[model samples]
Target: MNEQAAEIRKARFGALPERVAFEDMVEEKAVLSANHARDAYDPDGLAVRFSCLAADLGL
Candidate 1:
């Protein structure tokens, strides 16, 4: 019975996985985008420019 069980186990899972301690597994790292700049300036300038453009177009 033991020999039959061993053969069945071997057939089910071809080989045992390489043992890896949990601590040895790769860990996630915090990532942040460095190239992007925050738009901290007020939208007044954009509003003024867009209003002028719209007026010129009679929109």
Candidate 2:
């Protein structure tokens, strides 16, 4: 992330959780999708992901 974005993130999240880093969050979601695809998938999981993403983007 750029310096300004990192600063914004720190301010919003109060020193962001390690797992909540932007890149890490994307990776986490990809892993979630892959794992779910390999087994049983919960439709709610994708909905929850979209809700979180929308909220984060202030939509």
Candidate 3:
């Protein structure tokens, strides 16, 4: 039974790679946008948004 399962697993997945590159695993993108710089660092704006979200969730 174990041999049959092993054969099925091997057939389905083929062989595993010994190592994977970081570049192969991730697609890099910008974390911050250029246009929203004015509002991005506003603590009051963040606090208001957080409070709204928490209220919406009844938290």
The local distance difference test score of model 1 is 0.77
Model 1 residue runs over 4 Å out of place are: 22-24, 27-30, 34-36, 43-59
**lDDT per residue, candidate 1, 1-59, as tens digits?**
99999999999988978999988998988886564435555576667556676766888
Ranking by lDDT: 3, 1, 2
Candidates' TM-scores?
0.32, 0.24, 0.32
- Tens-digit lDDT track of model 2 for 32-55: 345656476677776765667676
Query: Per-candidate RMSD vs. true structure?
Result: 6.2, 22.9, 11.1
Q: Which regions of candidate 2 deviate over 4 angstroms?
A: 16-59
Which is the winner by lDDT between candidate 1 and candidate 3?
3
Separately for all candidates shown, the number of backbone clashes (residues 3 or more apart, or on different chains) is 0, 0, 0
Mark the 10 consecutive residues where model 1 has the least summed lDDT.
Answer: 33-42
Worst 10 residues of 2 by lDDT: 25-34
